[model samples]
Target: MALQIFNVLGREKQLFQPIEPGFVRMYVCGLTVYDYAHIGHAKNYIAFDVVVKYLRHSGYNVLYVQNITDVGHLRDDGTDPIIKKALRAQSAPMQIVEMYARSFFEDMDALGVIRPDISPRASAHIPEQIKMIQTLIRKGHAYEVNGSVYFDVTTDPDYGKLSNRRIDAQQAGSREEIRGEKRNPEDFALWKNAEPEHILRWDSPWGEGFPGWHIECSAMAKKYLGDTFDIHGGGIDNMFPHNESEIAQSECANDADYARFWMHVGSLTVDGMKMGKSLGNFVTIKDALKRYRPEVIRMFVQSAHYSSPIDYSDDAVQGVARGHERMMNAVRLTRRALATAPQTDDGNAILAAVEKARADFTAAMDDDFNTPLATAALQELTREVNALLNSGTTVGASVLKAIAETYDQLGGAVLGIIPATDDSAAGNASREAGLIELLIKLRSEARAAKNWKESDRLRDELAALGVILEDRADGTVWKVN
Candidate 1:
């Protein structure tokens, strides 16, 4: 089946056809770089990362671009979080941006998200933004007043095409602080007049000012990916004013479509509300990592559809971690079996199961990147593979290799829930697995000798270290807790 994407622009699922044959140009709005990336950020970025991975895995040469906003992410009252963070840290605004930007990438890397091909910073592309704003002004789509520029929403009849908002219905000049200067309440800023004390000031056509939060994405995306790209993505919360305004200004200035498909990830919530720093209910990615493995977090994100909200809690992530341990156990055991399996072609059933699993996984992913279904296919295959391995069947090395390759491709490469190595905290290394097996054997001997004290001591020690041993009638099997 061909890939279908839920494009927010048209409000329907459409077949994904890149502009250029066998190539895709995609852009996603990036972080503002004032604070640590939170689980919400992880959900959004990981969703897009999966999309990019699947595109490349499908043989498309993808040019992915995500921007960094160092300046012009303004609050309702004209305050920049970057500047506020700078003041609190006793540093420059750029210093705050640099620090948090690197931290964001660090968290993403730990989660195994592939980095974009181009990471254009907003501050570095002032010329491009200024030029885009100049074009808007020249085309009468925007106007400059009192050393500030605002996109004239009244001029674009299709202003609310993305957000489905009507200009007359919106409370014009709702923000009294900038209402007096803006022609309409729905009008949004392309450039803001920087204050004398503002540290992140730049010289623009409007005056000494900074680019507005919305303009940076439009300018940067166009500069890197052109006016109309294959896909544009961001959080759903930004759909209304931020994304809506981008369409108005870009289409008006460039005389073309902004992006072909719009994909927005749903919010990551806590206690039925959005997880945000302002809400004080957010968990930073670093803090979450300290509590759970990165793959565990990624699995939790994949448990829900990208457009469906997933709640965060300690209990939720713990459940995901347990399930991840079970999945990795199947993978680890298969690799171990490969070393000892017979050479005879007597495992055609397992090979057929692997083929069926591959087909099911691809179909699920092709259906709007439905990760939960795709992952379910893998989990089902794991169950079948486990039963065969534990049933004392004469499985061949070729069958084990095929099973391992399916997990490595669909789970490791596509979903990214499976790591390339078992050396991660989430999975026991081969050496560690061997040592645990040896200890299990010793504990068995102790039990056989009726030395309950030594047997219990070994069991308790392993449990303390999160190695859970299940004693079956045949023998004992262990899994990472």
Candidate 2:
């Protein structure tokens, strides 16, 4: 099956046909960099990360760009300029940008989100943004007012095509308390004039100010991916004002479609409420990582479909931990079985199973990147491998090796789980020695007291830890192998 992706712009699952054959250009809106990253951020990025991984696995060259919104992100809840709010709060814009950008990257790295090919910051691309805004003004799609530029949404008949809202309807929806300078209520700013106290002011044709929130994306995306690109993605909340304005300004400026496929991941909720800092139920990624394993957190995020809301909670994370442990145990057993099998030249059955699993995984992914289903397929394969290993049939080493390779490719390379095993056993040896010494000391104490129960318990515990103890003719001996 051809790869199908749910294009939010068209509101349909369309077969992905890259503009350049065999190459894909994708962009995702990054964090605003005003606070530490949260599980919502993790869910969005990891979902896209898997999409990128699977696309490459299926033989597509993807140039993925995710922009970091370090500036031009407003602070106030309503339509007032965010920079004005920042100035009133007496916080330097760059200071806020630097502090939060660092926190965002740290949290993302902890969550194992592969850094985008190009992470353009809005502040760094101000010139590009200004240029685009100028082109929009020249094209009569934008106008300057009081040293600020605002996109004239009234000029673009298809302004709300992506969000499927009529311009009149949007104007009616936004009728109350409209800004007097805007030609229409639906019009959005391309540039905001800086007050004397605005710390992020820059020299622009309009005035000394920063680019607007939506303009940075249009500018940077066009700069890197051309006037048109394969994909543009962000949270669903950006659909109306942010992305819609982007479409109007960009298409009007360049006289071309901005992006072919628009993808928006759903929100993350906590206890049935949307997870936001203002909502007071937000949990930062750093705080969650301190409690849960990073892999468990990732698994929790991936448990749901990208276009659906993922509810965050302690119970949910614990459930993910349980599932992760099961997969890890399966991998461990597969490795041991492979190590003990006899050598052989050929193993067709194992090879066939591996091929089938790969094919099934790809098929599921191609169908709109159905990760939840793809993950289920992987779990089923792991179950089959474990069952085969425990059947007590004599399997050849070649077959076992094939099973190991499949597990590594799917689990490590694709899913980003299961760290690569190193050839040196120094770490394992040290751990084994420490465990053995502790177990022997406990067993001797149990024997001294003639406590059979305690002695058996100690032996069982060691066995659970992958250690085996045997009573020899001379004395008790332990062998790691």
Task: State candidate 2's TM-score.
Answer: 0.86
lDDT, residue 306, model 1: 97
Give the alpha-carbon lDDT of every model. Answer: 0.88, 0.78
Q: Which parts of model 1 have CA positions greater than 4 angstroms off?
A: 169-178, 277-279, 424-452, 467-481
Model 1 lDDT tens row, 356-462: 88999999999999999999999889898888877877778888888888988889998999877664222454788879989999999998999999989999999
Candidate 1 residue pairs that clash? 172-185, 173-185
Off by over 4 Å in 2: 77-92, 169-176, 345-352, 421-481
lDDT of 2 at 14: 95
- Please report the candidate that would top TM-score against the real structure: 1
